[model samples]
Each structure stands twice: as structure tokens, then as C-alpha cells.
Target: MKIVFYGVITAIALSCNVQAAAIDFSTAWYQVAQKNDALQAKKEEVKYSQALQDAAKSLYLPNVDITGSYTHFDKPISVDTPPVGNFIPSFNVPLTNQNFAHSSLNAVLPVYTGGRITAAQDIRQAQVDEAQSNYNLATRATFTQLVQYYFGVVLAEQVYQVRLDAVDALADHLNHAVKFEQQGQIAKVERLMAQVSLDKAQIEAQKSLRDYEIAKLALTKMLKQQDSVLPTTPLFVNNSVTSVTPYLTKTLTDHPGIAILNAKREQAKGMVDMASAKHLPEVMLYGNYNLYSDDSATGELLPEWMVGVGVRIPIIERSGTSQEVVAAKSSVRQVNLLQMQMQQDLSILVEKTYAEMSQALEEYNSLASSQALSEETVVLRQKAFSQGLSTSLEVADSQLYATSIRVQRLSASYNYVKSLAQLLSVSGDIDHFMDYLQINGIEVK
Candidate 1:
């Protein structure tokens, strides 16, 4: 007994060591989630905001530009030449090429813009907001897909294990029946039935193994990795269903759709501000300097600058600025109505998810009981067969019934998990199922 206990301990220690050395599924899933493509896209969106904010600063700064031009006149203008019909004294006048080269540096500094610059800057800011909201939505989609694939692979592995166990049990039963037949305790028909059961179990196990491989490959592809020998151990998934009503409410209030609508409405309001400002006069301070060489030497090489206030009052209004204001107001009202509709839809989705989860839980519980009873029935049928009271068909039927019950149990587990996912998806946050998401290294928050 001591020797057997020591062997078991050594085996368990070795298994633990192997597990530690192997690539853990938790870390693998974490790496996958961290490097998701959608997250990368979201990170890129921050640059758009940075650029727009920088552009807004342009409104507060003066605009400066440098320009240079060169002009060459082949025939110079000579006032001494006379051309007449009667007394045509055609005097040959000498002309030289007149080459003009000038360079100027000019600047425009806005002393006041009647708020047009500010309105334009606000419009740019609204564009950044729209990009930001789009990125947020993309991240949500990527995270949800990762969750679905991760759980799917885990379920496939579980089913594979169940099939493997069935194969082994059937093989053992076949060997025992053949021995009993040789000793004349069981008929030839019983041995043949056992052999056929073992063959069917093997076939089922092979199909399940193939399915498991395919599922593993799919998950690997999603993680952006090459095909690999999948980890023998299954991924950890938390089956617990936690409350998500508060999160759902927050999501409805703060979702990307709402953000986009708000940004659009804000942009429309800024447009109204811009149009109204068009009616108001804009004031700008400007300065320029120039030097002329031959054209009467009009300007000196010294400084030339001017600072003044400019204004323009609209004497005639073609497009009513007041109409633009009214239109913008109407748009704001439309967006508000849409937001209300979204909230109502979200509420209905939450309720439906809750109902699905409840139903899944009930089915899982019922299947669990069925599996337990089927297992006991298998044991009783096997004993009856050994005592020569039950036929081969009866034993086979019991084993198949037990297998079917196990399959149902697995299906129930999958259904329950999927329903939980649906609930989290509508809630717009999966923190309630963070334990399952932890496989991909995603923190709930």
C-alpha cells in the first residue's frame, strides 16, 4: 500500500511538472486578446484627435507666407518712337530687356474673426469625436468574437474527452465478453455484440477527434498563429451567471452610437454658428514689405506694416441664417428621438437575454439528472448480463442510452454558456463573465 501511494504521488508530481512546462491555455488566450487587430485600429484613432486639436490651434496663430516671382519683357516700352501716316518719322529707338525680380513676405493676423474661426475649429473637433466612437465600436466587436471562439474550442475539447472515455469502456467490455464466450459463460452472439459496440465507439471517437482538431486550428488562426499541436488540457470557463443590468444601462447611455449622434448634432450646431458669423464683419491685421529697382523706385527697402479693424454688414440676406438655426434645432430633436428609441430597444434585448439564460440553466439541470440515472442503469444492465439474465441487445442498449445522456449533458452545457454570452453581449460589457475572458488576458474593466 505504501509503494502504491508513493507511485501515485510521484505520478501526480510529474504531471504537475509537465503542466508547468507546457504552454498554458490561459496565457495563450491572453496573448491572443492583447494583439487583436481591432484594438490596433482603435489605438490608431487617437492620432486623429491629436491632429485635430493641433489644427484648432491654427485659428489662434498668425498666418505667414513667403512668395517670389521673376518676369522678363523681351520688348521694353519706348515712348520716343513715333508712327504717323503723313509725316512718318520712324525713329529707330534702342530698347533693352526689362527683367523684374521681386520677393515678398506677407502676414495676416486675425485680431477678431466674429467667432468663425472658433466654429471651424469646433467642426474639426467633432470629426475627431466621430472617429473615436467608431474605434470604440470596433474594439467591442473584436472582443466579442474572441470570447466566442475561445469558448467554442473549450467545448469541443470536452466532447472529445467524453468520446475517448466511451471508446475505452467499450473496448474493455468487448475483451471481457470474448473471454466469457470462450469459457461458455456467454453465447457467441454476446461477444459479437460487444465487438460491434466497440467498433462504433471507436468510429465515434475518431470523428470527435477530427472535429477537435478543426476547432483548434480555427482558434489558432484567430490568434494569428500557425497550426499547432493543441494543448491537451481544456481552457477554463466560468459557468456562473452574474448580474449585468447596471452595466446594460450604462452601455445604453454611453454607447458609440450615442456618441456619434451627439457629435453629428454638435457639428450641425457649429455650422449654424458659422453661418450666423457670416453676417458679422471679420477683422484682420496685415503687414507687407517690398523693394522696387527700376519702376520709378516707388518703395524703399525699409519696413512697411499696417494694423486695422475690418467689418462687413450684410445689407441683403439671400439664405436666411435664422432658417439655418431652425434646421439645426430640428436635427437636434431628431437625434434625441433616435437615442430614446435605442434605449427602449436595448431594454427589450436585455429582457430576452435574461429569459434565455434562465431556460438554459433549467435544461442543464434536467440533463444532469438524466445523465446520473442513465449511468446507474448501465451498471444494472451490465450486472444482469454477467448473471446470464439479460441478452446482448439489452446490454448494448443500456450503453448507448448512457452515451446519449452524456451527449445531452454536453449540449446543455454549451447552450448555457452561449446564452450567458448573449446576455453579456447585449449588456455591452462582459465583466460578469470575466473569469472566462481571462483565458485571453482581457481584464473585465
Candidate 2:
């Protein structure tokens, strides 16, 4: 019966290993980039902004249109001349027919718009820049999330393996205790105590398994994968200490949030220019060609074609152009202040994340010696227990202590990984995260 139970467990493990799709960090990032809806939405927004920019450029081109109209008068338009002392009979001269139809092709080209066109173009360009920055920000956020879920799975798997090992060790100890009790070499209480520890270890193993499954599910969902993912990248830590100065510098210089604010400031400046332009005169070149005229009188009255330059000067305006300029200037100030605040916030975030990463690294390094000693103690206690020189409780405690140290070390490594991702994310250096991994990472054993 025991053999069958072990066989079933082995089969299930093998099946899971076969069904799971192994993915490396680069592959996972690529999948997320291709499949994430939010990232795609941001990309579409960039395209939309670009289209608007193109439309703004068209303002520099001439606008042409064809117009046609038909009108009916109450009666035929005519003029009658009275006879001069009956020497000449009265005569009627027709000015136009009762119905008239006319059609024309008209064109207007902007010679100058008091800089309104240029200002509009500048505003649109700034909007494009802002949209691009937003997309970049979304990309960074998505990649950071991927790092968390991807490494989270690795950490959970390592923990579950440690738990399984603990359960296996306790089962061996329990088997030994049972034999010793049957041989009258140990008390029955010792055997019962070993049984209880094994039971608890098994329960802990089940909990670890559940955690692993949850972590895997999160990663799979992020990548939009139908199959379970087996992360090939192990959780890693850097032994060398890193300074936070570079990260702070990068954050202040290259962060997307800062870029967004700068674009907004440019947009506000353009708005100010546009509002000021409204107070100046506009110049345009316009031309029209008569396409058709149904009445001969109308055709004779209207010119066949005409071309002229036109100017529109604003003598008195009540459209609040001054107020608009003031509002735009205020917006500029607001954006500048926001940029400053974002810089300060990002710097603080970088510092905090760096400290946390360093702390986790330090903690992991500090536990190395303790982990070694715990393992050694576990071996010694187990040997003594088998020889009737130590109690089952002592052996169980040593085993549990070793397992605890291992789990703690794994947790510390996981924390370090997450913190590193966050630090890079804030610093706008997340694109080079893989390079850092290659340079400083040590894979967990």
C-alpha cells in the first residue's frame, strides 16, 4: 500500500512536469508585451496622438470647396422706362429670371494666422510626446509586474520543495522511532511524538503546495497563457553592495513621469501662444471660379473668377483672449510644480527601494552560517536519536530549525528580487534589468 501511494505521487509529479511549459525571463517579457491589453491600449493611444499631429499639420495647406445654390424670386426682375412725351414707346429691360442657379469652386489659403497655426502644431506635437511617454510608463509598469509574478512562482516552488524535504525527513525519523519502540529500545511516547511531527510536516507541505499553485496561476494569467508556466529563471541575489546614487540620477533625468510633465508644460506654452495670437490680425489668400449659372442675367452680373488677399484684424474682442492666456500661463506653472514634486517623490522612492533591497541581501548573507549549523545539528540529533542517546523531540526540533532557516533564506532572496525590480522601475532603467541580472545575480540552489 505504501509503495502504491508513493508511485501515485511520483506519477502526478511527472505528469505536472510534462504538462507545464518552461519559460525564461526574456520569453515571459515578450509574451506579456504581446498579449497585455493595457499595454496595447497605451500603444493605440500613441497612434491616436500621432494621427492628431498629422491633422494639425494639414492646417498649413489650402482648403478648397465647391458650393451650389438655387433661388426663386416672387416675380421676374425688370425695369420699365416711361415714354418721353409720347415720342417713344415704353420699354422693359429684364435684369434676371424668376429662378436662378449658380455654382462656384472656392479656395482659401492661409497666408498668415498670427502664429495660430504654428501654435496649434506645437500643441499637437507636445500631445504626441505626452502620449508616447505614457505608453513608455505603461510598459515599465507591466514589466515590473511581470518580474514580481515570475519570480514569485520561483520562490514558491523552492519553498514547497523545502517543505517536501522536511516531510520526507520526518517520515524517516518516524519509521526509525517505530522500529526502536517495537524493539524496546525507545519509549512508545517517542514513536507517537515522531508520528505527530510527521503529520504536521505533511500539513505544512500541503500549504506550501497551495501557495505554489497560486503563484503559478498569477504568472500564467499575466502572460495570458493557457498552460501552466514553469519559470526557468531562478530567484537571485547579488553579493556585492550597490550604491543608490546612479538610480537617483537616472530617475530625475529619464523617468517617464517627468517626461510627461515636460510635455504638458510645452503644451501649456503653446496654448499661451495660441491665445495671444487671437489678438493679432490674420491674412489669407482666397479665390473663387464660377462653375455654372443657369440664368444669362446672373452669369453676366457675377464675375467668372476672382482672386484677392484678405485680412482680419481684431479691433475689439470680448472672447476672453486675455483670460485664456492667463489660464494657460497658470497651467504652465502648475505643470512645472508637478514636475518638481514628481522628481522629489521619485528620488525618495528610489532610496527606499534601494535600502530594502540592500537589507534583504544583508539578511540572506547573515543566515548562511546559521543555515549550515542548523543542517549539521539536524544530522547529529538524528544519529543520536537512532542510537538511543537523544529524544525524538530534539531531533524533530533540529529538523524544523533547518527547514525554517532555508525558508527564511528563500524569503529574503524573493524580497531582494522584488525590490530590485521596483528600484529599476522607478529609475527608468527597467529595460536593462536583465543586464543587471547577468552581471550580479547568483541563482538560488
Q: What is the C-alpha lDDT profile of model 1 across 1-445, one tens digit per residue?
A: 2234334433542442342223344555466557877767666776767687687878878888876767777755444667787788767553333665666677778877778888888878887898888777665565566555665666666676676666666666776787789999998988899878877866676676667667666667777765442443333324455565674776677777778878887788788788778678767777665532334222233345544555556667878887877787787788788878877887777777666766766666677678888888878887887788786667777787788777666665566566666666555555455455454422210
Candidate number with greatest TM-score: 2
Query: Local distance difference test, per candidate?
Result: 0.66, 0.89
Model 2 agreement with the true structure over 173-255: per-residue lDDT tens digits: 98888889999999989988998887787778777777888998999899898889899988888876469998899889999
Q: Which ten contiguous residues of candidate 2 have the minimum total lDDT?
A: 1-10
Local error of candidate 1 at 248, Å?
A: 2.7
Q: Relative to the unseen true structure, what is the C-alpha lDDT of residue 80 in candidate 2, on a scale of 0 to 100? A: 96
Candidate RMSDs in Å, in order, are 7.6, 2.0
Relative to the unseen true structure, what is the C-alpha lDDT of residue 138 in candidate 2, on a scale of 0 to 100?
A: 94
TM-score of each: 0.75, 0.95
Name every residue pair that clashes in candidate 2. none
